[model samples]
Target: MDLNDLHGIGAGWWSRILAGFHRDAGLEPTLLELGLILAVALAVSVPRASWRYFGLFVTMVHELGHAFAALTTGRLVKGIHLRFDQSGAMMSRGSGRAGAAWTGFWGYPVPAVVGCILVLAAFSGWSSLALSVSALLLLATLLFIRNAQGAVIAVGLALASSLLVWFAPAALLGHLTLALGIGLLVGSVRDWLNLLGVHTRRRHQLANSDAHILARRTGVPSALWLAGFAAVITACWVHAGMAVAAVAGFPA
Candidate 1:
């Protein structure tokens, strides 16, 4: 079936799913949207090939989080590397202890924060704004994508987001924002869970994990960093859920 026909089939269900996301004229996600967000997150978390490909978007956001944190903390970011395997990394140089620590700490939590914000925007009827911000972030990250695979992915996403921000219809844009948010949430949760596994075992490839870097820089244990990362992600989940519920006219 064509795009329109596909959209038509799910239109009724999408309407119900997003029923309470909008109220009045403001742009905060309501209870219905929040529930939808979690539901979508869970769906994307399933181990399927389609979901796995979508996970690439999540990995990009996760790596860009590190890149942005590095730049924000006065570090010079050399480049970002996204691999075919869906693992990614940010290369940067910073001598400041705080900068190093902050960059490393941000890697795990940033995706959830970004996703939550986008979900809020989507419910707020700010699809244009949501897409614009996302587009800008991806474009800015393009300057730092060093590897060929990363460059192609970054450029492709940047172009797609830009086009959507400028041309997509309101309803389609909203769905896209929701999808992005859901993917990010799923990816963040999955990544943290993987780290938790490594933490429990007390062994992981140090070079491949953020917690190890944080531990090395801050003289803290990797397990502690992993715990803190988990806590931050949990906080994001709670915040998004409560905000959605409160706005949906549910009693907070």
Candidate 2:
């Protein structure tokens, strides 16, 4: 079967699954043009076994986002990572309530943004460059950062998010924004509590402890950063939408 045929079958299966979920939730899930995009991405990504390294790159992007956020807030980055079993790069910021909050709040959005970029690149026919850049980013992140779980989670999340965007651009993008925000909020709260010595159990430990380094001057407000992140995500959605439109020969 042609790639399109294969993708159509996959899309049909996914549609049924989504329809079931939507019915259960008393909501509607729009049919998206993600199948073709996914087919293209898969066709391009699967040929080379080395493409798996892109996973590492996704991890790096996640860590780099945390690192950048911490740095912007005047926090020191103790370490970072591009590779690990369960996490991504870890930043070690100094001790402070604001610093802790910022670190936690900045975690998930980075990977989400990276995933958006990857989707854009893939759809725009920059697959090779995307894969190469992703691999390099992952290698660098692993070399520099320390949070294994964050790196791993970030990569996994990015890939999953990209797939969602590819398959269901409209619904998935909004959902991703909300989900990412919730995750960041939860992470921040957990980190703040951990910093206060509220949770000492190893099982309850935050993932990016290494990413939080020495504390620095409190510069930008976490709220502002979050707002900016939201904007970036919106832009990403627009880009993805346009790409899909172009692929369909619709006016962008």
Best by TM-score: 1
lDDT of 1 at 82: 92
Name the regions of candidate 2 deviating beyond 4 angstroms.
Answer: 1-36, 39-60, 69-76, 81-89, 92-106, 145-228
Q: List the residue pairs that clash in candidate 1.
A: 27-124, 30-244, 31-244, 31-248
Ten residues in sequence with the least summed lDDT for candidate 1 = 16-25
State the TM-score for model 1. 0.79
TM-score of 2: 0.41
> Where is the poorest 10-residue window by lDDT in model 2?
20-29
Across residues 157-197, which tens digit of lDDT does each residue of candidate 1 receive?
87776666555665566666766776677678887887776
Q: Relative to the true structure, how large is the alpha-carbon lDDT of every model?
A: 0.74, 0.46
Residue 109 Cα positional deviation in candidate 2, in Å, after optimal superposition: 2.6
Q: Per-residue alpha-carbon lDDT of model 2 for 98-136, expressed as tens digits?
A: 766666556545555555554454443443344334434
